[model samples]
Target: MRLPSTAHTSRPWRIHGIAPDFRVEDVWALPTPGGPDDLPHLVGQFTEGEEPGMAGSSFAYRTLFAVRRRLGRLLHLDDADGGVGGRVASLRDRLPADLLAAPRGPDSDALPFRSVYLLHDEWAAELANRTVHAVLHLGWVPDGAGGYRGQMAVLVKPNGLLGAAYLLGIKPFRYVVVYPGLLRSIGRRWQETAGRRK
Candidate 1:
């Protein structure tokens, strides 16, 4: 699904005060074997010793680039440009043809995948809480040593505030399994980063 433009003009969301009121069920991941790893480690590293959490924000941005590198390797996409935009273009080109050809559905059983980001406002909550958004990026990859790799990122913004992005990469697998726990772990890392902002 199309996401709110990542432009600076968008109103900043409020992250402080009340905890964000968002559901965990809405989060989803690409169906892949072995799912994502190092989630707790990532969160701990991000939250360790940081006062406000700016370190986590920096880590998220830097981590995205690292993920782009791994994605290039899995997809066999060249990263001569060595930038996020270039990496995404390469990934789009490498998606398995079958996934692109199949119709969209919850049970397509297809390996290739697409992603969506969900957003919710206080209208759905009791406290008139801050606007909350979740970024979900999903796609399929090979399995086993030879299988493809799938990767996705879930970013949350509270009260119109945007900070601390979270991402998870799935190893190659025949059947993809979306994990809610992993998403929550990622969201927490993002929150740590958001908390650090000045």
Candidate 2:
């Protein structure tokens, strides 16, 4: 479900250290519930598929994503010069000493992002293109029933005026289509892991 930005900003996330300039675009309470240690399971579910959070979701989500890709390709929005390490530097280059010592989880085969750091209850990954440089941060928080649930925060730095307009244009669809579809897939994948834990 959609959450107030404070849900993420109120927490002392490591992301604050690295990308303070980036705006918090979205914060969500993922439906995956489990013990504290289950965060790895949560992360695994998200990073599992060739197209994470697409399977079992409404076809609208896939179509939106496909359209995005087609547009990006035609406009050269995701070209080599527009991506991380090209248009802008990777967040990894800005990691603090302690975060550098922390585990940098494996890069996703499914997404155009690389791990930043992994803490006991938090994991962050970064992606960038001509439009924006962004971070996906997941945190495991107490769900108030003596269990934990995942929370996701999206942080972004728009490249320029074009990036700003780009973000504005997609906000409506992201809320109405993208996030809903993603949350559904997360719940489905998380449930599949439940039986194995039995």
Candidate 3:
């Protein structure tokens, strides 16, 4: 999806020091196309609610919570009574603390932001070894401004070394570029969804 040029022209969001206060409400492993060892792999969402907006103003908090629940189930192999909780916990620990911070309101003292950490490490080396392409979509419910709603999707195709380095914390600069695009895509998707619903 192409984003609005105006959105691109503006200043981008930045993540300085990690948020001192944050919690991992949930996590899960994304399913590979075939089995557990597929090359193009993905992990589940670490946070529980909506993502940040393009203009850095608003978001859909509840929908993200619901998505995490559903992703949790999918990663659990549909066995609600099984090891899902453990899997989520394990993955949650690997995420950056800021990514797990509580969602802030548009006017709150906190900055409006959201993030996901994708890793291709020794534990899941197969994913890191391949040329993987990934995209994350976050549903949003715009605060007020009528019944309009939307979604934000971040698509990434990190080269093998860069991708692996990102997961390892050896390279953090790439996120600076990646996140703004994510915010923009999310805002556009939310706007389109809201327009269609009306």
Candidate 4:
């Protein structure tokens, strides 16, 4: 479910340190509730595209990704020349010594994102393009019952007026279509996978 910005900012997340300049675009409570050690398993599933909501399965979810890609191509939004190291700097460059030494699991092939860092309870990935530079963060939060649950937040540094406008335009679609499908799919996948592990 969508949450208030404070839900993300109130947490003492390391992401805040590196992305102070960016805005917390969105925060969500994922359905994948589990124990502490379950985070890596969740992250692994995400990286492998095992989550059904991400790629396809649902018409709405698939269509959203398709439209975004087409728009990106048409507008040259995700062009390499206008992406990280060109239009904007990479967030990885700002990592502290300890974070720099931390594990960077893997780069995302489907999403134009690069691994930033991976911690025991959190993982972050970054993407930069013409419209905005963004970070996708996944965190493990204790559930107060000797377990944990997944939390996700999106951080974005819009490039200029265009970036801001683009985000504004997509906000409704994200809320009504994109996010709902994503959460539902992830939840179903989590149940399927978790069942197997048990």
The top-ranked prediction according to lDDT is 2
Q: Which residues of candidate 3, in runs, are more than 4 Å off? A: 5-95, 101-129, 139-145, 160-198
For model 1, residues 151-181, the per-residue Cα lDDT tens digits are 3433333333211121222321101222333
Candidate 4 residue-wise lDDT, 19-83, digit = tens: 89999999999898897778887776677664337644567777888899898999888899888
- lDDT of candidates 1 onward, in order: 0.30, 0.88, 0.29, 0.84
Deviating ranges (above 4 Å) for candidate 4: 50-52, 195-198
What shift in Å separates residue 51 of candidate 1 from its native position after superposition? 33
Best to worst by TM-score, what's the order?
Answer: 2, 4, 3, 1
The 10 consecutive residues of candidate 4 with the worst lDDT sum are 48-57
Model 2: how far residue 124 lies from native, Å = 0.6
Q: Which candidate is the best by TM-score?
A: 2
RMSD for each model, in Å, please?
20.3, 1.1, 17.1, 1.7
Worst 10 residues of 3 by lDDT: 120-129
What is the Cα-based lDDT of residue 128 in candidate 4?
A: 87
lDDT of 2 by residue, 24-140 (tens): 999999998888787777777767676676887688889999999999999999998888889888898999999899888767788888888888899999989989999999999
Please give each candidate's TM-score: 0.21, 0.96, 0.23, 0.93
Clashing pairs in 3: 60-141, 149-194, 150-190, 151-189, 151-190, 152-186
Q: What lDDT does model 3 reach?
A: 0.29
- Compute the lDDT of residue 87 as modeled in candidate 1: 22
